[model samples]
Target: MRTQTLLTAMLIGMATPAALAGPAADFRAADANGNRQLEFDEFRVFVDLRANGGNAQAKKVRLFKAYRLALGKVDYDGDGIVTGDELIRFDRANGKS
Candidate 1:
């Protein structure tokens, strides 16, 4: 049973990075200006576009807070920008990889 549990944990850890690859690709594509970083407006648009058709206006305040929190996590350097490398580091820190 212990061996099986260890194997399962290993598998999950390995798959985490692969699962995040799609989001990384989406981030790259969402970088319209190709500045290699996501600014507030760009990140906002990306979040809205990926919002699954939800009525953003209905939850404007809540959504804004959530967006800010997400961006804060990725903007590790606190420079008001999110780069791909920062995103990867964020994911790792958040246990997504």
Candidate 2:
């Protein structure tokens, strides 16, 4: 019984992040002008995700830089723009689905 309970708890813990990740990504994508791709200005979403009840303002600049790199990498085409199709392709290629 204890082993079963432990296994269930482990499974739930592992699943939680994956479940939460989608919603967060959706939220960020929406705020990114409905493009489903993130831009530098959209860094706010990621910043909000990483910020806690502490030092949010302090972390702003660093988060912006990190978000820039992250967004750049995901843009993939280097066209200075990202489309919904591109995002979907990226997600699939990265095994998001």
Candidate 3:
């Protein structure tokens, strides 16, 4: 628990934005391989299994579009993928303290 707290603190400190995005747990889960990054594949699963609830096949046809939107929204580097730092910054900018 202590480690987790530290990690969360680190994440928040690293974040650059000022609004809440999603919970840290959400980002951690979405970041497969624990690489602190979310490739389209990881983002896809995260989107489908988000707290809102949805199935993988439900948005198969629109995942690509969603990816593009995600890029525009949080992929600050425009590197075709979402990083933990970028997401944290976005989250903070949105509302997360």
Candidate 4:
């Protein structure tokens, strides 16, 4: 548990805030179900939170696009869920984070 915490902190700390474009905290916040993994709905909520919208409707639109793109990029096993490990691997593989 200690090691996992340390590793999470290390990974979070290693990425500069700017590089992540607000996603580090966003990812944590997105885990809304508290399951330590992101369901599609939770991920949609997260992407919605991170998206910029001129108004509520615009935000929803942006969120939908972002969610679709993010789902494609992160859901590696097509299991319809995303784990932190999967997220990390996706980011690393894509030259992100």
Candidate 5:
């Protein structure tokens, strides 16, 4: 999957999503390998796209910080990978499921 699309997928319940698709859509697009795990580098791109500011560089910085902050919460295994089951659990916990 493209980096941006994957990044966007990892963000399951953001109030202001940069991508038009919802969490399920993003997840599906990212999990192309059928392993049901979304490896995020593109997820970073998705977060970067959500960063607001006039400077592109500033947005990138924000994206990295934000992504790091969020990674742990979603990556339950600490493996730096988010599986479909993980997303579902997260969404349910957040009442977004």
Candidate 6:
């Protein structure tokens, strides 16, 4: 019985982070129309800014490019999209949530 209690506590402790892992605001961005979809054009705007001599925007452009790649990898359902649910799951799996 003591061993059982200890095991249960351990399991709960290990599971706590997963349970608490939910969507976060920073993991998302707004699109042109102010909708929250990870679209290509939103990313391109950053690139365009940099091309126009916005060095600060270049940094953001690179960051978003990396994010886009990472998000694409997580979009397993392949609806050519990554919804909030998908983002949450990806973050939880990566321990970022």
lDDT of each: 0.53, 0.43, 0.53, 0.56, 0.52, 0.40
On TM-score, the leading prediction is: 1
Please write out the lDDT profile of model 2 over residues 11-97, one tens digit for every residue.
221111123564355445535566555465654454444344232431443444444444454466886554445445545555454
TM-score of 2: 0.41
Query: How many clashing pairs per prediction, in order?
Result: 0, 0, 11, 0, 3, 0
| lDDT of each residue in 9-97, candidate 4, tens digit only | 32332222234656556667778867777798877665565554122432543534545545655678988887767777754664566
Candidate 2 residue runs with Cα over 4 Å from true position = 1-38, 43-64
Q: After superposition, how far is residue 10 of candidate 3 from its true place, in Å?
A: 26
Best by lDDT: 4
- The TM-score values for the models, in the order shown, are 0.58, 0.41, 0.51, 0.56, 0.50, 0.40
**Better TM-score candidate (1, 3):** 1
Off by over 4 Å in 1: 1-21, 53-65
List the pairs of residues colliding in candidate 6.
Answer: none
* lDDT score for residue 9 of model 5: 45
Taking the tens digit of each residue's C-alpha lDDT, what string does model 6 give over 14-85?
Answer: 111123331122222234555555455543442343334433423433544543543354465876555556
lDDT per residue for candidate 5 within 1-97, as digits (tens), equals 4554444444544422222355445545545565656677645543344443232432544555656645556677889876656656655666564
- Which 10-residue span in candidate 4 carries the lowest summed lDDT? 9-18
